[model samples]
Target: MSEKQETPEQRRERLRQEEGRGNPAGDMNDAANRASNGSLVDLTGSLGWKGTGILALFMVLAFIIYAVFFR
Candidate 1:
């Protein structure tokens, strides 16, 4: 008996069609959630006490410099 075999592209298309039957939006959301598992800004890790202090110090110093020089 002569049977026709699916080509690689046809197999791939069939698999893709099968995958499309699932929740694509849910899959995308799952991927996004995995990608952003933690905080977006990460202030706790990237800007700890020292970084916060430095930022506060810069703001205060800038205000003082502007008041003394320009105001």
Candidate 2:
């Protein structure tokens, strides 16, 4: 039985072909050209008016506490 081992160049070409087949048109690179694949932080959809008001109140309270105690 005769078995042929792949050369380094042949192996590299094979891997390159596999990568091309895995992601045609090199679109995967384009798609991954970002820090993350998800959207930025946006609470507008999840936070209702009441939630927004509460968040604002918390911020004001935090600022007041920091100023009154730290100053």
TM-score of each candidate? 0.38, 0.42
Clash tally for model 1: 0
Score candidate 2 by lDDT: 0.62
Candidate 2 global TM-score: 0.42
Tens-digit lDDT track for model 2 on 10-35?
56556666777877768466446423
Model 1 lDDT-worst window of ten: 38-47
Instruction: Kindly report which residue stretches of model 2 are placed more than 4 angstroms away from their true locations once superposed.
Output: 1-41
In candidate 2, where is summed lDDT lowest over 10 consecutive residues? 37-46
Q: Please name the candidate that would achieve the greatest lDDT relative to the true structure.
A: 1
Candidate 1, residues 1-71: lDDT per residue as tens digits? Answer: 11258754456556655675697887577557747795423443457678878878998999999999997
Error of 1 at 6 (Å): 49
